[model samples]
Target: MRYSKEHKNQTHARIVKRASVKLRERGAHGIGVADLMKEAGLTHGGFYAHFDSRDALVIEAVTHAMDRSTERWRKLSEETPPEKRLSKIVNSYLAPEHRDNPGQGCAVPALAAEIARESSKTRRVFSGRMEQMIDMLADQYPGLPRKAARKQAMAALATMMGSLVMARVTGNSELSDEILKSGRDAVLERAASSEKKPPRRAATSV
Candidate 1:
């Protein structure tokens, strides 16, 4: 029996979606092609029909994960006031729950270490996703100059990612919590200062 084109497309999408979550939980190498195909309810032979190679599938999966995280951050950002958005994002990103559940959290920080060794194509996708994430963050600051806003966004993102990485690498739960709290406080404090600072003006002759 044969399936319709639409059905094939749907199956392919399902495979990507499933693969995205799996990739987060288990790094790219953690999942075998046959296992992934079976998990997607498709045959291993059909894998090539949907993707040229496992590398292609890995790239697609990473892209999908990035898209999912972006949407989640957007929704969270939209609901909160601009001033509070960074704090909320930091809290959520650095939380123990987010750290423990890689399948449902942001893939960028979760897979950052592994992605360093991935193919150039994969790294490029990751870099593009990071840029989009930064842009989304910059949108939260309405009155700031574009350059200042981007700088602030970069700082906040770096803090959040660094905290999560530290928490994941440390064995002590107390230390993990401290790392998250410190990161959150640092970002919130910095954002508050940014909001308060007056724009710099051209210096006049003394």
Candidate 2:
């Protein structure tokens, strides 16, 4: 049966959305194409109609997941006070809700390791999304220069992602919570300190 163009687009989006959650819940290689198609209520044979290859689907899924996360961060930043924007993002990202819900949380903590081993094209796609995330994070630090803000964002993101990975893997629930708290505190502290320091004046020649 021939599906209309709008219907095909909707079906393709549904498949990609499901794949995004499943990819995060399981590793990149954990689920097969057939299973993903089946979960989307379609046959494996129809996969080719929507995507060129499994790698293509994977790239699209990763991009979709990161886009959702970025939108959430952007909303949080807009709703928060200028002074507290970074803290709001950090706390929300490191919260227990995010840790316990891998399928619905940030892709970096869930798929970074797998993406690192993927093909160059796949890695490039992931890198581009990550750059968008980093730029969004840098915007939270309005007090710093562009270079310094980006550096701070990188460190904050590393801490948040690392803490989340540890929190999810550790057997002790208390330690997991502590890890989240420590990560949030550390990021906020660093941001606060950086904003407090006066900008250095360029050295003048004698």
Best by lDDT: 2
lDDT of 2 by residue, 148-186 (tens): 999999999999999999999983499999999999999
How far residue 75's Cα lies from its native spot in candidate 1, in Å, is 0.7
User: In order, what lDDT does every prediction score?
Assistant: 0.87, 0.93
Candidate 1 lDDT: 0.87
User: What clash count goes with each model?
Assistant: 0, 0
Candidate 1's C-alpha runs over 4 A off are: none
lDDT score, residue 140, model 1? Answer: 70
Model 1: worst 10 consecutive residues (lDDT sum):
82-91
Error of 1 at 23 (Å): 1.3
lDDT of 1 by residue, 1-206 (tens): 89999999999899999888888888878868999899888789989988999899999999999998889889998898876776677788879898788898888877888999999999999999999999988877777899999999998899888888788788348988898889889987888888899999999998
**In candidate 1, which residue pairs get closer than 3 Å at backbone N, Cα or C atoms, i.e. clash?**
none
- TM-scores of the models, in the given order? 0.93, 0.97
lDDT, model 2:
0.93
Candidate 1 residue 133 C-alpha distance from true site, Å: 0.2
